[model samples]
Target: MRHVSGLLVLAATPIGDPRDAAPRLSEELARADVVAAEDTRRLRRLCTDLGVEPSGQIVSYHEHNEAAKTPELVARIAAGDRVVLVTDAGMPSVSDPGYRLVTACIDADLDLTCVPGPSAVLMALAVSGLPVDRFCFEGFPPRKAGERARTFAALATEPRTMVFFEAPHRIAETLTAMAEAFGPERRGAVCRELTKTYEEVKRGGLATLATWAADGVRGEITVVVAGAEPVVADLDTAVAQVLERVAGGERLKDASAAVAQASGLSRKVLYDAAVAARAT
Candidate 1:
């Protein structure tokens, strides 16, 4: 059994529009004993905008300081202080700085709660027109080109739709890498400046989206990519695909590796499938 001394509230702040702030968010900010904000300045601005002055103690809690701050916040919560955690935008802990603190509080057996508000994740998915029933969020790909390509290669065969957050400068490069690694015709959407005045959601094949992003883009970016289609049970197609890559100068090992990486099957299994395919 676990014991909790005080409530740990994970409050969601508006991603862009202040009007999207829920009523409960204001109440929580006003009533909490300690408010842990990713950016205390932003939180103060938000409070000013909402016409609510937080009577609680304010502390900065972000990626750079989360580790050091978590234990202290957990202690406060354990001491029966009502702690409310808020990020600069969207829900805390979703590609943001709230997970560690929340996990710490949980480990300390503190009562946890949330004041739900607007989320860019749900908003982008809703407008993406992609299959959202089954999906996963890949917070951010590796910043380096090679690592990013490898990461996408690993996900090529994932059956469920995938979402990713990317920086503006890297969006085009990432899309191009995805197209090359996952196939040019894979369906995807690039959502930018979600919920803001200049919001945009471009939907098309990965290759086309890559071209569109090549000209340069700005603002926050969230990409939703369609999962690879089921592997063609017909061994002929699989072998043909592998052979084409091999014929195009890719080594047999590299071709097998690439195909298998994208298709979610063992390389050995794919090699066997390729051998059987060649024999026929």
Candidate 2:
């Protein structure tokens, strides 16, 4: 029997500027057997901007209907359709629709690929002036005030840069919550309208950013916050804590390593001190 070819293509759309759309995106959009879009209207506008008309069936695949539509799309792909998936902006499945379809395709053992393009998270982090060596993309903070506060507080000790998306209207309240939870002096950057004509990146302490957004900013917002500084631990204190844990049945080496990690001290120093104390 001749093998039938099938594939699922996830194409990333430009976040703000149409010019950032990838050339491969236009090619796939034009040649695919099925174009599943988060918003068919937005896809049409994008096609107009790219100057490429999709020569395939365009179907609506969004949050509201994805659960029901995924099976149909999977069946079509299983039968040799080249289905291209595109969200309203940025890559699909990154705080966007298409995750279900992708998982569905995986379960069916179908081939899949992606058309790379612009990402608001990367763009924001790059311009945020924070330490980008290590970072975390925290989609969107909780909307409710209490939940939001609790969430930020839990991440207060995070030692890697953090990135988040926020609605323009809620930016002020969100920033204020961040200020209270992560400390007003904690530095952060508010990137608005990235890659667009009115692009702006405001870098400063979290409190300052909160005050700036209090005046009511507009457009897409991406915030990047610097990581918490490592806690400086005293050698005597860390050794005592390790010894206490060891007294509670943990191995001396294991206790020392755990205490060193929590206190940001040297594991070797902690272990040696604990051993010395035990010997004495």
lDDT by residue for model 1 (1-280), tens: 5655588899999888899999999999999999999999999999999999999899999999989999988888888899999999988898999889878877777789899999777888899998888998888999998898899888988888899999999999999999998899999999998888999999999999999999999998899999878764444566677889978998877888878766656788778777676677
lDDT of 2 by residue, 205-269 (tens): 99999999999999998999999998869998898999889889999889988898778898998
lDDT of each: 0.88, 0.93
Candidate 2 residue-pair clash tally: 0
CA RMSD per model (angstroms): 5.3, 2.4
Indicate the TM-score of model 1: 0.83
Model 2 TM-score is 0.91
RMSD of 1: 5.3
Error of 1 at 243 (Å): 18
